[model samples]
Target: MLLHPPSGTDRVQGLAARLGCTVAEHCEPYGKFKPAVLGSLSGLALTLKEFGGRWDRVERVYVFANWPMLEAALEYCVRNRDEARVSA
Candidate 1:
């Protein structure tokens, strides 16, 4: 699963070109589908932070990871006063 850029912006494609796995689905609402990789959360966060072009245009990241990781990420963001990437 991957985060999409804001509406009207282009959908980020070819991530599989770099990551070696094609996106199984898009528009996967949180809690509805399982994530194939556990590390994608951190990978995406770091990627968006370090490379800020269209990534920064991302408006939300709907988590498909387990509830614990999701809560932890949200808690960390709240504690650090950072914007949450996770969408409801």
Candidate 2:
């Protein structure tokens, strides 16, 4: 799956389509879907462990290969901090 990160969702999706693969946020009930390859592991775990505490302010890229990517996404939310990014 090619997760559509806010910065380039459409581009990723288009690329995945061209490559003849599925792209999605959640893993659907299928025997043929694959998650997007995003990052390494050691990096991802720490990020999730850290950002898990601040859920209200950040969002995550569920298609992460490591905790660092999750942390990075959270950090991005912290940096972007856009009210519009948050919704009711």
Candidate 3:
């Protein structure tokens, strides 16, 4: 559900791997949620830690599973992004 800026897919995937995630680069029907990485690696160190080290930005590492997870992530991502723009 994360709307990456142009070409953040590969970086996201690598992050997923570093965190012990299994990435699926495409989702049918819900193609809008393409390129998902199921499961999570909370115990492992986040690979995006260098990307400013913010929980929000690192969390956008893009991982999802099931319909509800996908839906929630999409909503949250959009809302957070909008909030960022408004504040900026």
By TM-score, who's the top model here?
Answer: 3
What candidate 1 gets wrong by more than 4 Å, as runs, is: 1-32, 35-44, 47-62, 82-88
User: Candidate 3 — what's its lDDT?
Assistant: 0.42
Candidate 3 vs. true structure, TM-score: 0.31
For candidate 1, which ten residues in a row score worst on lDDT? 48-57
| Tens digits of per-residue lDDT for model 2, 26-56 | 3333633223423332333344445442221
Question: For residues 1-88, could you state the per-residue lDDT of candidate 3 as single tens digits?
Answer: 4443235345444544544554454423456544444445353224323222223233344444333443344344345546878999
lDDT, candidates in the order shown = 0.33, 0.38, 0.42
lDDT of 1 by residue, 1-88 (tens): 4433233211122332233222222234343542222223444565333322122123233332333343343334343433333431
Error of 1 at 14 (Å): 33
Greater TM-score among 1 and 2 belongs to 1
Q: List candidate 3 stretches off by more than 4 Å.
A: 1-63
Q: After superposition, how far is residue 1 of candidate 2 from its true place, in Å?
A: 12
In order of appearance, the predictions have TM-scores of: 0.27, 0.25, 0.31
Give the candidate order by descending TM-score: 3, 1, 2
